[model samples]
Target: MGALDYLSNFCTVTTTRTKHKAMQTVEIKVRMDCDGCERRVRNAVTSLKGVKSVEVNRKQSRVVVSGYVDPNKVLKRVRSTGKVRAKFWPYVEQHLVYYPYAPGAYDRRAPSGYVRNVVQAFPDHSSNAPPQENFLSFFSDDNVHACSIM
Candidate 1:
């Protein structure tokens, strides 16, 4: 076989395009003080090629972008709009936080109903079960070793 025939047999020739990112929602915190700020951020994010939608919540200083978009690009776009303080949303709902008033979880500046989500800020959840459960566990039938106290 000639060189062309040898290569064709070994490798199929096909055009390839860059892989697209998965559809996802990226939430960002942008301190939008006025309608102008909100509009600016929304405009910047919507300009991106793959952005399907942009929702700006000025009250909560939150921006939710949904579609096949790169999160870094979205954040960069928001910052480029002169919202220098823009960043990925760092807070979770107060209920998700183990300690609502944790030293780091509690943010006076954060909007109501949310708290900073930091691993170190919350106590371990494994210990949160009631004390009664611990005593009952000792007597559980599954326990091969019975408690000495009956």
Candidate 2:
């Protein structure tokens, strides 16, 4: 046997290692009105396995979940609360119907330019506005008033 052939036999082989990706944050558009509703939804989601943290913004009517849990599974747990319903925000196409645009309702919509004005009036709402932009636009005065919760 050649010297090169003998060396090849003793060569050590190494495999490349792949790192697992960190879990993504899941944002859910939930219909929660009161403190009780928020608490119920928060408790339900935080109790699930793989859930690292949960933030429920009652004013924005949204829940942001960060953890290793599947988003769908987290949604199911939030919905199971029975006090309110939770859905992946992106999947809610009919925001007007799902959220309704009035004034007081948890799922209600704000008026036209409401977002911009909110930002002008309260800069904090600006940070919270982006997530609800699509939902708010659906409530423009030109749209059907039937969907208005007011």
Judging by lDDT against the true structure, name the best candidate.
1
Query: What's the lDDT for all of these models?
Result: 0.86, 0.66
Q: Write the per-residue lDDT of candidate 1 for residues 10-99, one digit (tens) a residue.
A: 798687999999999999998988888888888889999999998988889899999999999999999999988889999889887667
Q: Alpha carbon lDDT of residue 18, candidate 1?
A: 94
- Estimate the lDDT of model 1: 0.86
What does candidate 2's lDDT look like per residue over 1-150, in tens digits?
Answer: 699898987896878996654688998878787889889888888888778889987876779999877887888888788844556763232332333232333323522222211212323443645554466555757667645446
Please give each candidate's TM-score.
0.76, 0.46
Pairs of colliding residues, candidate 1: none
Stretches of model 1 off by over 4 angstroms after superposition: 3-13, 121-150
Residue pairs in candidate 2 whose N, alpha carbon or C atoms collide under 3 angstroms = 99-107, 101-109, 102-109
Which ten contiguous residues of candidate 1 have the minimum total lDDT? 129-138
